[model samples]
Target: MLTPDALGVATASTVKTLKVEAPAARSAGIKVKSVEELVEKLKNEAKVI
Candidate 1:
């Protein structure tokens, strides 16, 4: 398992972006292709990444 802060999450913008789209992120696709699957995708499927 990965630590909560292993990634650069020590900023306000990062936190906002996380919560803003975490409600409905996708499991696969270019929108969120981190492979780590840490970020939650939104339903809209917009280009936030």
Candidate 2:
């Protein structure tokens, strides 16, 4: 995770580049069963909601 200071410096830099990558899906199948379940997990576990 980027610190606040590091994020500020990165934002101020003239050269801007963004890269995003997704991990390969597990062979066991989907982790969360459904969208609602996923949202619930995010809210309860991740506290992202």
Candidate 3:
């Protein structure tokens, strides 16, 4: 009869496991009085500019 080892089939014992974690959510954001303030925050805090 054919054996599992001879067939090279992967089982739960042969598979690797990992401990994953979820990232933290961003804040609700602050209100800006003008376009300049928004740009400043995007450049300094968000760094997306």
Could you give candidate 3's per-residue lDDT for residues 1-49 as a string of tens digits? 9887789986547656677788899879679999999999999999999
lDDT of 3: 0.87
Which ten residues in a row are the worst by lDDT in model 1? 38-47
| lDDT tens per residue, model 1, 1-49 | 6655888556445434334434666587454567444344442344366
lDDT of 2 by residue, 4-44 (tens): 78666554558756876899787674598799999998899
The C-alpha TM-scores of every prediction are 0.15, 0.38, 0.42
Best candidate, lDDT: 3
Question: How do these models rank on TM-score, best leading?
Answer: 3, 2, 1
The lDDT per prediction is: 0.51, 0.80, 0.87
Off by over 4 Å in 1: 11-49
- Which stretches of model 2 miss by more than 4 angstroms? 1-30
